[model samples]
Target: MALILSQLFISLILSLFFSLTLLPHATTSKANSSSEYSITSIFNVTAANHKTSQILSFKPFHNQEEFPQTFSSSSSFKLKLYPAASLYNTHHQHKNYYSLDLNASLNPGITTGTSNFLVQIGVGGPPQKFYMIFDLQTDFTWLQCQPCIKCYDQPDSIFDPSQSSSYTLLSCETKHCNLLPNSSCSDDGYCRYNITYKDGTNTEGVLINETVSFESSGWVDRVSLGCSNKNQGPFVGSDGTFGLGRGSLSFPSRINASSMSYCLVESKDGYSSSTLEFNSPPCSGSVKAKLLQNPKAENLYYVGLKGIKVGGEKIDVPNSTFTIDPYGNGGMIVSSSSLITMLENDTYNVVRDAFVAKTQHLERLKAFLQFDTCYNLSSNNTVELPILEFEVNDGKSWLLPKESYLYAVDKNGTFCFAFAPSKGSFSILGTLQQYGTRVTFDLVNSFVYLHTLCCN
Candidate 1:
C-alpha cells in the first residue's frame, strides 16, 4: 500500500519550576560497592505496525560539513552500563521539574527535555550547581545563570560569574577550545562558544569543567563533562548533559576504552527498553565501547540487526535501510532506542512491495477507517488500525501485537509512538517502535540483538 504524506506545524510548550537544596549524600553509592550493577529497565509488551517510511530521510544541508555522515555495516557484540549522574535536589533550590528514577533493565535515569541540574562550575573550595541539559547530541555542557545577560528564567539557578569564586575561561588560542564546534575567540581573552539545537533552541557561553557522577559497572564515579557559563533551552530542569558521545569521558568514550556493553528491546508497536553493562578491572587495563569504533560519522550508530519475521515468515530488512548505534566493550549489546521512521521513497517502496506480495491477510482491528475514533478488537481497546504481523530482521518472526502500536513518554524523555504512511501510505518504525524485550548493543564486537519478544 502507498502512503499519503502531509505536513502539520504544531507548537508545544511546557512549564517547570525549581528550588535548590544541598544533597546529604552525593557520593554514597559510588563510595560503597564494586559488585556488578544494572541500570533502569522498562520494556513494554505490545505490537502494532505502521506504513511509515518518511521520517528516515536525513538530507544533506548547507552546514553539511558541520554534521557527520552515516553509513551501514556490521561486526561483533558487547554491552556496558554506567551509572547516570543523578540530577535530584543536590543544590539548595526549588524547581518545578519531575524526577524520574533510572531502571535496571532498559530506561536510563535521565530527565527529559529542557531539564537542567546545578553543579559547581569548577573544582575548588565551594562548589555550586547550575541547571543544564545533559544532551547526548551535544559535546560541551554549560549553565545559564546570573552571569548570562537576560538568561532564560530557571528558578534560583543561573550562571552568575560574579558569584563564582573560580570562573576561569578557556583561551581562544587553545587547540582544545577550537575543537568545540561553536568555540570562538572573544575580545575579553576568554574562549566563547554558542550551540544551537535542531529545534532552533540555543545556548552560548564560556567553557569550563565540573564533576559529573555516574555508575561505572557498580560504583559511582565523578567524571568531568563540559561546563558552559551561558546556556538556554525551551524547558529547564536538570543541570547539564553528561556527554555520552564518542568523546573522552562520555558514555561512548568510556565504552570505547573499557569495552562497555548494553542491550535494548523494541516492540512491534512503539515502546523500548534497554540495559547497560560494564566490567573494568580497577587500575588494570583500559576499556571502551567496542561497537563505537567506526561510527556512522553522524549522530547515528550501528547495531547488527539479525532479521525480522512475521508468523514465522522471514522478511528481508536490510541494514542500509535503518540507522543503529551499538554500545559496550566486547559482549552482547542491544538498545531499545531508535529514532528511525519510514519516510524515504526507497524504504516505503520496500514495505509496499513486501505487503503487496506476502500479506495474506488485511485486517482492520480497531478505529474507524477515517476520523479520530477508537475501537475494541477482541476485547483490546485499539486507537487506529488493526494489527499486522511481519518478521523482524531475521532472528525470530512472531506476531506483531495490536497493543504495541500505542505511545508513551518515559523518564529520560524517551517518547514512543507509531506513524503510519499519511492517508494512504505505509508506516515508519522509530524509537517509538522499540517498546518491549531486552535490546542489546555490543560496542566491542559491533552487533545488535534482542533478548526476547512478547508473545500474543
Candidate 2:
C-alpha cells in the first residue's frame, strides 16, 4: 500500500522525532532485543496458469497487534490512507468471493443525485446503508454519523453512541488519544480525522466512540469513529467502515477468532467460499508473550509466490515482487484473486501479439484466470486474444486454490501493483482470474508463501 497524504504527515513527524534521537543507531543495537519480531513459515505450494491450487497453511490467531513504532519518526515521511474496494467471499462449504463492479463502461457510470452504487457499513448480516469506500487495505472498522442520524435505511443495525450507555470518548490526555493517527482535535475535546483519497475525494469529522453489534456473537464497544456533519461522496450512505486490516482499532471490538479473514472480489460474481482458515503449529506455551512476533511497520502480509512462467518460459522477478507493505504506506497487498485476473489479461495480451507477428492464429491455450464472472469467459461479441499460461512458483509449488477464497484481486492491472487503501487504492486478486489456491499471508514477514492445490 502506498502511503496516503495523511499518513505521510504523521510519518514526517515521526521521522523527525526519531532522526534527532539517534534512532538509526538505536535500531541497530535493538535488533537482538526481545522487541524483534519474526514470522514462521506457515505453508507454501506451487501454482500454474488458469488453475486452482493450495500453497501454504498456517495457524490462525484470534487477534494481533501492530507496533506503532514501525513508522519512522521522520518529518519527511508522508503517509496517507487510501480507501479501496475489497471482495469478501463468506461461504464455508462452497468456493466464493466478493466481486467488484468494474466501470461497467469505464466511464464512471452516470448516476442520479444518488451515486450508482451505495457503500454501506454493517457489523452483522444486515447492512447499514451508507456511503463508504469498501477499502481492502484497512482492517479497523469505523463510520461517520451523528449521535442520532437517519439510520432507518440501514440493512444492518446501527450504533447510536448516544444510547450506547457505555460509549466514552478518549480524553485529549488519554493514552488512546493517539488512535486517531492523523486529523486535528476540536476544543470540545473531540478528536478530528481528515482523510483524503488519491482520486481527490475527501472526508473529515470529529472522532467519537460507539458500540458495534455483529451477529457472530461479537460486539465491540467503545470503538473510535468519525461523526461527520458534512460527509461527502458515496461514503455518507453508512455510519462507518468495517476495517479488515491487521490493526485492533476497527469496529466489532471483539471476535470469536483472533484473526479476521476477508476476500474482496467483484460484487457481481458472488462468493467462492464461506470460510477462510489460517493453520500453523502453535507456538510453544512457554514462549514469553514478548517473543510473539509483531508485524513490521513497513511490512504487510501476503500469500505465496512460486515464481512466474510465461508461455512455458519462466520469467524472473525479484522476491520483492511478491512482498507487500500492508502498512498502507508505500507497499503492496496482492491476493490470489487479483493475480488470476492479471495473469489472464497479460496472457491474452501476449497471445494477441504472437498472432499478429505470425500472421496466423496460435492455438489458444485452455486456460482460466481466477475470476468467477461469466463475462470473463464470454466472447459474446468481443473476440479478444487467448490467455497465456504462466506458472506460479514454476509449477513446482502452488497456492492451494479453492472454489472460493478471499483475496485481493490485482489492483490497476499493474504487475507490481501497490495497494494503499487510505489513498483509495485496494490491490486485490479478482476472481475473474484467481479461482483456486490455498494462500497464506505472513504479516510479519515481507514474503508471500504459496502452495498450489488442485481444484476438486
Best model number under lDDT: 1
Candidate 1 lDDT score at position 118: 22
In order, candidate lDDTs are 0.32, 0.29
Lowest lDDT 10-residue stretch of candidate 1: 7-16
Indicate the TM-score of model 1. 0.49
Candidate 1 Cα outliers beyond 4 Å, as residue runs: 1-135, 159-168, 215-226, 229-233, 247-296, 317-319, 322-403, 408-429, 435-456
Candidate 1 lDDT over 203-289, as tens digits, reads 676665433222121112232234455555544444454343334435455324443333223221221123334342112111112
Query: Candidate 2, residues 315-399: lDDT per residue as tens digits?
Result: 4544433334443322223422122233223333343344233322222222212222211211211122211222233233221
**Candidate 2 positional error at 10, Å:** 41
* Candidate 2 lDDT score relative to the true structure: 0.29
**Runs in model 2 lying further than 4 Å from the true structure:** 1-134, 147-158, 179-181, 236-239, 246-258, 263-306, 310-313, 316-320, 323-332, 335-396, 399-428, 436-456
